[model samples]
Target: MEAAAPPRESRPGRDWDRITAIAAVLIGLAAVLVSVYTVLLQREQVRAEVWPRLDFYYAGVDGEFRVSNKGIGPAIIETVEVSIDGVPVRDWAEVTARLGLSDPGQLYSSLWGAVLSPGEHLAYLIPSGQEAFAQIRAETQRISMTVCYCSALRDCWLAAPEDDGQVEVDACPVLPPERRFQN
Candidate 1:
C-alpha cells in the first residue's frame, strides 16, 4: 500500500478548539445583550420625546379668569377637564354644548385663526372669576394636557399624555406663540 501519510493528526488540539468555541459563544452572547439594551434605550427615548405640555399665565378678566392653551400639540381642548382647588368645573358641559362640535379642529376653526397640527399652540378660552372657575392668581395651577398625533412612522399615539411637555414634529420643538392668548 502506498505509504499512507502518517495519519494526519486526527483532530485539532483540544485546548485550541475549546478556546475558539468558547470565544465564539461569548461573542454571540455579547451581541445579543447589546441588541436588547439598544432596543430598550430607544423605547425610553421615544416615550420621553413625543408629547407636549404647556404652562400658561392665568389672569382675571371680565370678572372671570381666562385660561388659554398656551402650549400646543393639536390640543384637544374639548377633552380638557379643568379643576379649581381640586374641584372639577361643571361649566365644561355648557361650554361643550355651546361649542356645537366635539372635535378640536372644528372648535379651533370656530374660534379664531385656522386648524393647527401637533405642537405648541393656542387653545380655547376658559373664563375665571365665576364661582365655578378656578381662582385666578399669579400662582401656577398644575395643568395636565392630553392629546394624540401621528408620527412619521404613521403610528398614532392617540390621547396619550406627553410626559416632557414637549410638542415635536420629527423630533423638533414647536415654539409657543410669541403673543400670548388674551380674552
Candidate 2:
C-alpha cells in the first residue's frame, strides 16, 4: 500500500499577498482624496488673488463724489442708481434740478459699463466751488446712491453711500431704461 500523502500545509504567503493588495488599494484611495483637496484649495487661492472691492468717496471740502477700485483686481460698474427721498433719478441733470442747484458747470463721468482698475478712481460728480459743494452736501441728507459692480470672476457687490461697506450680491438687478442712471 502507498504511504498516505502528508497533509498540505496552509500557505501563509498567500494570506500576506491578499493583505498587501488591500493595503495598496487603501493607500491609492487616500492619495486621490488628497489630490482633490489640494486642487480645491488652489482654486480658492486663485479667486482670492483676483477679488475686487469698490469704494465710494465723498469729499465735501473737495466738492467731489468719486468711485474707486481699492482692491487688487478690476471692478466693472454694472449700474448706478441715484435717488432723492427714495425716488430714482434718471441722470445727474435731474438730480441737480430736483435739488434746486443751478448747474455749476462741473465735470462728471459715466459709471455704467465703465471699468475701474486697481487704485483708479472716477469722479462721478464734481462741483465748481465750495458754495455748490456746501449746498449739495446739505441737500445730500435726502440723497442716496447705489452702485452695483462685478469683478473679473463675476463676483458682484452692492455699494452705497449709506452702507458702511460693500455687500456681496448674487448678481446685480437689471434696471429698465427709465430707472437706470444715465450719468
Candidate 3:
C-alpha cells in the first residue's frame, strides 16, 4: 500500500553502538592499570621496613687486629673481648684486639679508642710480635667481639659476636684502607 511509503530508511551509521563498545574497553584498561600501580607501591614499602642498619667487618694480623664498622651512624666499639674457639682466657687477657683510627701513612698512638663517625673509620691494633697463648691461625682462630655503640639517633645496644672465635679480619672499614694490612 501506498502508505507504507518506504519505512523511513533505517539510520545509516551504527555510531552509537561503536561508541559504547569503545568506552567499555577503555574503562577495563583503566581499571587494570590502576590495580598494577597499587601492587607495586605496596611492594616497595615492605622492602624499606626490614633492612638492618649496621655493617660489621674484621681482619687479623700477626700481632694487630683490624675491626671495621661500616654503619650509617657513629659507633663506639668498646672492649672487644677475644676468646679463641670458645675457650675463655683464664689469666691475663691473652688476646689483644684493639681499635684505633689510622691516617694514610701512620697509625694513631692513642692507647684507647672511641666513636667512629660516618665515612670516618678506625682500626684495632693487637700489639705486634707477641707469642699468642694459642696459635692464632686465620682459619682456626676467631674473634668473638662485643661492641657497645650508641646510635646518633639515640639508640644504644650491644652487638653480638658474628664469628664465635674462628678467624680474624685483616681490614676493618672503620679504619682507613691504608691502615689495613690483609693477612
Candidate 4:
C-alpha cells in the first residue's frame, strides 16, 4: 500500500478568498444600481425635451381664411414668409393683388404679426359678398409658407408645409434676432 500523503497546511489567504468573493459581488451590485439610476434620469430628460408642441394651420370661419396656432405652448414668431403661386408676398396688398381678391381691402390691411400664441388666430375675411370670395378661391393655388418660431425656452422650430406634415425643431439659439414682421 502507498504511504498516505502528508496533510496539506492551510494557506494564509484561504479565509480571505471567501471575503474577496463577497466584496466582488457587492461591487457588481453597486454598479448595476448606478446604471439603473442613470437610466431613470435620462428618461426624465427625454420627456422634458418633447413637450409643448406648436403648429400652424388654416381655418375657415364665416367665409374667412384664418391663420391660427393650435399648440399648447406660446410660439414666439421669428418670421412669417408666405408665397403664393411661387411669388413671395411682403404684405396684404401683395396678397390681394396676387390672389385677385376683388374689393377685399378692409380686413386684409391689418394682417401683420411675428408672434402668435396658442388659440390666437389672424383672419383675412373674404370680401363681404359670396361672389367676391368665389373669385379669390379660384385663383389661389400652390400656397407655400415658412413660419420660424421659438418657445419661451428659446427652442426654435419651423412650421412648414414642405415637412410632410411635421414640425422641425432645433437647439440653436436664434433668439434676439429681428422678426420678419411686426404685430
Candidate 5:
C-alpha cells in the first residue's frame, strides 16, 4: 500500500462561519419584524389622536335641538336628514308646517357642511316660546334625525336618533336634492 498521506488538516472556523451566517440572518429578520410592528403602533396612535364623536341632544326645557362634538377632535358635518312620521322634510320650516305649528318663531342653524370643534355644540332648532316648546316636545315622538360626520382624518360615522349609538361608515351617502335637509 502506498505510504499514507499526511493527515489532511481540517479547515479552521468552518463550522463557526455557518453559525455566524445563520445568526446574522436571524437577527436581520427580527429587526424587520420589529420595524413593521413599530409602524403599525404609530399609525394607531395617530388615528386615536384625531378621532371624533358626534352626538345629538334635545333639551325640551330649553326648547333646543342640538348637535354636539363630544370627542377630542373636530367633527365635519357631512349630511343631515330629518323626518316626520318617516317622511323626509327639507328643512325645519317644513317640519313646523307638518307639525301644524305655523309661525313657531324658531331660530335654526344650518347643519350641512358645519364644523364643530371639540366640546362645541350647534342648536339646530330653538323655539321662541313655551307653547311651541311644549308642542314640539310632544311631537318629538314622530320626528327623527340622522346625521353623518367625519373626523379630521376622514373617518366617518352615522348618528341616528333610533340607534343605540353612532355607527361607523366608510362614507356618507349622497342624498338627492329633494331629500337633502336644507337646515
Candidate 6:
C-alpha cells in the first residue's frame, strides 16, 4: 500500500459490553436466591401444620377402665359413639335404654363434652349394686367408643377402636362456648 493505515482504536463504549454482562449475572443470582427463600418458607409452614400427634387407648389403671387421650395437642371433642360387640350405639338414649338405666348421665358423666388434654381420660367405673355392674364384671360386653375430635388448628381426626385406629380427616368443627367460671 502507498500509505500505512493508522492502527484501529477500540470504541469508547467498549466497557459497556462488560457492564451488561455483569448486570445479567447479578439478576440471575438474585432470582436463584429468591427461589431458595420461598422453598424454605413453605417447608416451615408444612411442619407447623402437621406436627401434633394424638392417640386413643383403653387401659385398666388400678380397677378403673378409662378411655384416654395420649396426645400432644388439645382435643376438642365433637361427637362420641359407643360400640358393643361391633354394633354401634347411635346415641346416649339408646345406650341408656339398652342398659335399662333411668338416666344416661348417671352412667358416664364425663363421656360428653370432654376436652381432653394429654394424659387425660374418662373413667368407666361400674357402680356397685347396679344390675349393669354384673355385665361389666363378667366382661361379656365389648364396649368401645369412637371419638371425633379436632385440634386448636381446626384439623379434624377420628379416634376409633378400628384396626387402623385414629386418623386425620376433615376440618375441625366449631363448638359452643365452654361454661363460664364462677370465680
State which candidate has the highest lDDT.
5
What is the model-wide C-alpha lDDT for candidate 4? 0.58
lDDT value, candidate 2, whole model: 0.86
C-alpha lDDT score of every prediction, in listed order: 0.38, 0.86, 0.43, 0.58, 0.87, 0.57
lDDT of 5 by residue, 134-171 (tens): 78878988888889999888999999755659889999
RMSD of each: 11.1, 4.0, 13.3, 8.3, 4.6, 8.6
Q: Which parts of model 1 have CA positions greater than 4 angstroms off? A: 1-14, 59-79, 83-89, 93-119, 126-183
Query: Per-prediction count of colliding residue pairs?
Result: 10, 0, 19, 0, 0, 0
Candidate 4 matches the true fold with a TM-score of 0.56
Model 6 CA deviation exceeding 4 Å by range: 1-63, 83-93, 96-106, 124-134, 137-144, 162-164, 172-183
Give the winner by TM-score: 2 or 3: 2
The lDDT of model 1 is 0.38
Query: Candidate 6 — worst ten consecutive residues by lDDT sum?
Result: 174-183
Task: Please report how far candidate 6 places residue 133 from its true position, in Å.
Answer: 5.4
lDDT per residue as tens, model 2, 31-124: 9999999999998887787778877778766789887888988899898888888899998878888898886587788998999988998888
Model 5 weakest lDDT span, ten residues long: 159-168
Candidate 1 per-residue lDDT over residues 1-183, each given as its tens digit: 798778656664577877999999999999999999999999767754543333333334433322233323333322233333443333334333333323231222122222234444343444323432333222223333333334323233323232534344432223234211111
- Candidate 3 lowest-lDDT run of ten: 99-108
Name model 4 segments beyond 4 Å from true.
1-61, 108-114, 124-129, 161-164, 171-183
Model 2 clashing-pair count = 0
Residue 82 displacement in candidate 1 (angstroms): 3.9
TM-score of 2: 0.85
Per-residue alpha-carbon lDDT of candidate 6 for residues 58-123, written as tens digits (9 for 90 to 100): 343333335566666666776665755666565544554555554332334454566777666766
Q: If both were scored by TM-score, which would come out higher, candidate 4 or candidate 5?
A: 5
